[model samples]
Structure formats: C-alpha cells, structure tokens
Target: MSHLHIRPKEAGADKRIINITPESANWQFVGFEVVMLEADDTLVVNTQNTELCAVIISGVADVTTQEQLFSNIGHRASAFDGIAPYAVYAPPKQELTINALTSLEVALCRAPAKGLYPVKLITPQDCVTMTRGSGTNLRHIRNIMMDNVDAERLLITEVITPSGHWSSYPPHKHDTDAIPQESALEETYYHKLNPKQGFAFQRVYTDDRSIDETISVEHNSVVTVPKGYHPVGTPHGYELYYLNVMAGPKREWIFHNDPDHAWIVNP
Candidate 1:
C-alpha cells in the first residue's frame, strides 16, 4: 500500500513501518530497511543489546567487524553484539548503500539462538535444497552450519521463478496447532524484485470465500500471515525474491495449503 506496513500484533491488523535508527535498535517484528550510506562514504555503527544480521542489498562497501575485515563488492556480514560496535567504508562511485537487518529498531523482532551462532555470509556455493516442486529454482540458507542456531526462529529461502510462471501460487495458510496434518505456524513475506525495477501481486484471505485481500507488492515490500491461505504471483516480465519468517509454540515451523489447490503440488 504505502512505502511499508507493520503488523505489530498478530491479530488481523494491516502492516506498518517504523523509521530505522541506531540508538533505538530493536528487532523488526515484520521488517525494516537500513540505509547504510548515501554515496561513497563511511559509517560507524553502534549497537545496543540487539544482535544484527546485516545483508548487503545493493552497492559495495568495506566492512569491518571486530578484528575481521571484509572488503570489496558483493558481501554480507553478521554481528552477534551488533549493538556493540561496527564500521563500514563505501566504495567510490556507488550511489545507494542499503543493508537489511534481521532485527532493527523494533520491539518484537526475534534474535539468534542463545549459543554461539556465528554470523555467515551466504554465497552461491552455499545454496542448498534445490527443489523443483515449487515451480521455481528455490534455494535455502537455513541448512548451513553457520546459519543453524537454536535461537533462530525464522528460516530464509530464496526463489527464482521464470517469467509468466508462479512461485507461491497454490495459496496456503498455517494459523493454528490443530494437527501436523493440517495446521502450521504463522509466517511473514518480504519481497524483492529481480529486475531491481519491477513489481508483483499477492493474495491473502480465508478459503471460505469470505474476507479476501489482495496486495500489489514491489521491491522492499512486506506481507503478513495471520490465519488464511496466501498465494504469490509473478508477472511474465519480472522475477521475484521473497524471504519467509515463521514461529510457533511447538518450536517447529510448518504449514498446510488449501485442499483443492493442494493438487497443484502434483501437476
């Protein structure tokens, strides 16, 4: 709808956005955008009590975390005591510098496990679980040794869909603990455009033919999962990127889609 939305409570409310700041650092319950640099510049960051997983969305920078120095282009970094201290140096000529943080300036954004969960940079070599069932080339980042942690409540997956094809097309929902056969944990969707200048469509609502809601999604947009089946659509001219976050009481994240459309899994 607007630039962004945030669903603070898990009720049936719409999404909202919160401005990013270093002093008020907290986990974003839905998600937040962190602007690292305006142009070729340097940024010194100070974290409070929150751990941060900063993913380099665009542009290049020389990042220094603790005693380790990560330099050059196309790199991501994670910091446990991100609330402690970190520094970044942007490259010459690159205009925009943005980094997506796991938890930022929010109250409910979840954090990594209690044990030693190392911060890792995902690479093409680390892409695992290439599945064909989802009608796209879906690779995941959770199975890695560095990404696996006990306090990590969210699982991030990346999907590349062909133009005119579907990714999360079947429309599914996981809103209860009814049974493993039909129930699942709640989830959140964060989208990114492949062309870096395109948009897609998404649908979320009850299956009983009541309470239907459709959202026109673009890059840096977010959708919420309350208690209904949701399906994502990618247009013929554009590809898509979506990050899913899930949590529940059973300590396991699972789901169940609409029954009639569930047959799409076979076709």
Candidate 2:
C-alpha cells in the first residue's frame, strides 16, 4: 500500500477539494477533506456513520444542526495568521447545513463513531496553543480536540513550523498498542504552505526501514501515516502549516520517539 497520499489543489471544482475516506486511503479510521465555498453558498453535511469536526480555515459561516446553530463562526483571514480557528463537532447520524456568510474555506476531519456525543462548538477560546521544541526545532502546536476533550476516538490538532525549522521533530510513531507507551492510531496530515508556492518535506519510516518514504508536500497536500515514525520540515524561506486528524483503537495519544533523535527532546 502507498503510504504517501498527496491531493493537489483543484480549481473550479465544486466546494470540496480533497476528499479522503478510509477506503480511498486504505486506512481504517481516519477521513479528511477541505472545502471552499463562495459567499452565500450553502452545503449540507451528513455524518452518517462517522463523526465530523469542521474547522474554519478562513471567512465566516453559519453551521446549523438540528440541535444548535453556530453563526458568524470564524475570524481568521488565513491559517498562517496564527489566530485560533473556529470549529464545530457533529455526532454520527446528525445532519448539518453550512451556510457561507463569506467566501469560506473549511476542513472536515472525520472518524468512525462508536457512540453519539453532544454537538460542541470549539471556538478560539477552546483551543490550547503552545510552543514546542527549542531553537531551530521550535514549532507552534494548537490542540483543537485533544484526548482531554469529550470525544469518542478522534484527536485533532494543528501545527505550524516556522521557516527553517521542523515540526513533528524527534520523529514519533503511535503505530503499536503498547498501553502507556504507545497507542495504535492511524493519522493524516493535511498541509498548507505560506506562499502557496513554497514546499515542505515529510519523512515516514520504520525502524527496520521496511516502510520508508520522503515526500515533497505543497499547498493542500494530504499525507497518510499507516504505521511509522513521521517527521516534517519546512524550507528556509517558507512556513508550513498542517492539520492532523487521528483515530484508532484508543482515544488517547501515546507515542514513541525515534531513539536516535529522542535525545533532542531530552537535551
């Protein structure tokens, strides 16, 4: 199976640009898509068997469900603006209508649902932003829906790697179900570059080097991690941003870092 999945930006398409399901990526639990809507446009979303988290990349939108309506729910101009994003979670079997208040760009992160959870709107105030690593390896991490959140199996977050730096450093893997040490989770990285022309590199590999690949990722690229330690790097002049969606047997994140680079995290 191909470990690296790349979906380029498709212009003049309907609203959905990148659509990734478990069958499409050959993964078990993770699914993701990016949608761009013009002003006043509307789209109906149904979470049939999967629970979805809709993240506002830019512009304003009113997301209405049978239980609640989230109006004027975005404030950032772009993902690179370093501002907290607006997001909403819809449980499985729920139907939602997204009305574009402005030209909107949104990301739909999904996973199979085992139980129905309450619909929650995760605003900027609900996000936890922190800086990770030190010096050149420093990067910004935004925890949108973490394990602490009341969710079934999805963990969503965003990472921003400054120019000339690395995010997801110390290459980590969560492919084994080793209890507190590591939990088996399938993950997907949906990436966006600062200048749209800029690019980034991602390496997914295993200890035996049996599963290994170094991918060149551009704007609107989606990278899937079936089982490996994955690391990402941005070039000298360009910044990199990516949204991570993960789900598996457990609802927590327990990972093991590459021993060769684990010292960096300690030292």
Candidate 3:
C-alpha cells in the first residue's frame, strides 16, 4: 500500500452554502462532487441550490456561470454541467506558474446537475490500454450518466492502474438478478495518485463469510460500496488511479463471481 490522500485546496467549513446533498467524500450521490480549486479561488453563487459540473484538474480557470463568461477556458480536463450562478477565477495570485509538470496537484471534479447523466470526456487516447498481473497497467474512463433507456445505471468508468498493475481482477460480484446472463451493480471507488504517492489495496468480502477490509489509499481517497465482492490491488510498484463510481438497479453491469474464482476468467 503506497498511501496518499491529499485534499488541501483549503475550504475546511465556512458553510457559505455547500450542501452537496449528503454522500460524503465531499458529497458522493445526487450526482457527484470531488472539488479542488486553488491559486485564487472563488466559488460563491449557489445557483439557487447547486447545479454544476466543473472538471479541470490542472491550472488556469475562469468561469462565470448563470449563462456565459468564460475566459482562458477550462484548462486541461474540461467538463461543465449547466444552470448555475457559478463563478471560478484563478490567476496571478502570486505569479501563476506550472509549466510542463506532470502531476503535482490539480483537480476540479464536480457534478451536481445534468439531466441525470450522460456527460463524458476521457482523454489518454480514450483509454483501452491494459497490462495485467501485479505489475498492472490500465485505463478505463466512462461516463454515460443516464439515458433512462431503462436507466438503472448504465456506465461510469474511470480506472487507471499504472505502476504496479492489477485492478479488481479475479474478484467479481453483481449481488443478484440473473436473467439475460447476470445483472447487479453498486460500486464506488474514487482514488487518485500519481506523485501524491502510494497505497492501493482494496478487497471487499464474500466467499462464505468473507468480510475483509483493508483501505490505505491516498490522493483524495474514497471507497464506499455497500455489498461485497470487490477487487483492487496494486502493490509491487505503485501507480494507481481510480474514479469508478457506479449505480445499479439494472441498466447493465452484470456480475457473477464467487464460483470457485470463476476460473480466474481464463486469461
């Protein structure tokens, strides 16, 4: 376990209107909110009660929601939902300087409103890359929010396991519901680590009383998922990233494991 969980953009609790709905890890359910904006931040204007989707995990930011006004655009990773008296401007607070650096600290992931889902933007060449075992390497980012096509929870992926590799492999669980094949989903794992450093070993239980718990994640660590049958391990070297929040009732995220390890899913 490398261990890293950094959240210091500075906003302890001045209230100033920050409901989040009640999910935890800085509000985890109505939509999602993993906010962090430094340099000369200003997040006022609640928009009558929250409705935002800000995502720019790097530097440079200047936004003024309610309708318009955006300068410098949304830095690197961009995603902004809608309808809000939103406002975020950061600059020169002391000679803004962050050039060519890889990952030293930068994040702004929020989701409070959007028709109920369907807002995606995954870069890293769209990610499909995967290298197995303990020396794991992976990248899977998804966002299908909701389509209501039956809408139980269609898709939402963000899994990047680099350094030591291995991700929720060989251990699966869907809870129940077997019709077309298998269907059940309820998962949430939000962890981010690059230079923030180490720690990554998560394993939920269920193998006949299996109730194991080991969580030592850093860099905005977050792991909460009621059921069991979870899997995520990256030990050998390090390098791990996570942001795979899911919802279920039945849209499609089938699962069926615990059958003698299911033959390790063959290769």
The per-candidate count of clashes, in order, stands at 10, 0, 16
lDDT tens per residue, model 1, 1-267: 422233223212111232222223322322233343434455444322333444444445555555445655343332111111122212112222222223221112232333233443444345343445443423222221124333344344445555566666576776667775554555556666767577777777786756477788776566666558777777877777665555444445456767788777755
- Residue 214 lDDT, candidate 1, scale 0-100: 76
Rank list by lDDT: 2, 1, 3
Q: On a 0 to 100 scale, what is the lDDT of residue 105 in model 2?
A: 92
- Candidate 2 per-residue lDDT over residues 1-267, each given as its tens digit: 244766756645467888888998888899888899989999889988988999998899999998999889999888999887999998898898999988899999899995558899998888999998889999998899995367888999999999999988889999998888899999999999998899999999999999899999989988999999999999999999999999998888999999998888786
Candidate with best lDDT: 2
Whole-model alpha-carbon lDDT for candidate 3: 0.46
**Candidate 1, which segments miss by more than 4 Å at Cα?**
1-31, 34-39, 42-51, 73-116, 129-131, 134-151, 178-186, 194-197, 208-211, 248-251
Model 3 Cα lDDT, one tens digit per residue, 97-136: 2221222123322332323422223332333333344434
Error of 1 at 2 (Å): 8.4
**Global lDDT scores for all candidate models:** 0.46, 0.89, 0.46
Q: Largest TM-score belongs to which candidate?
A: 2
Q: Which residues of candidate 3, in runs, are more than 4 Å off?
A: 1-30, 44-167, 175-183, 186-191, 196-236, 241-244, 250-255, 258-267
How good is model 2 by TM-score? 0.96
Candidates in order: C-alpha RMSD to true structure: 9.8, 1.5, 16.8
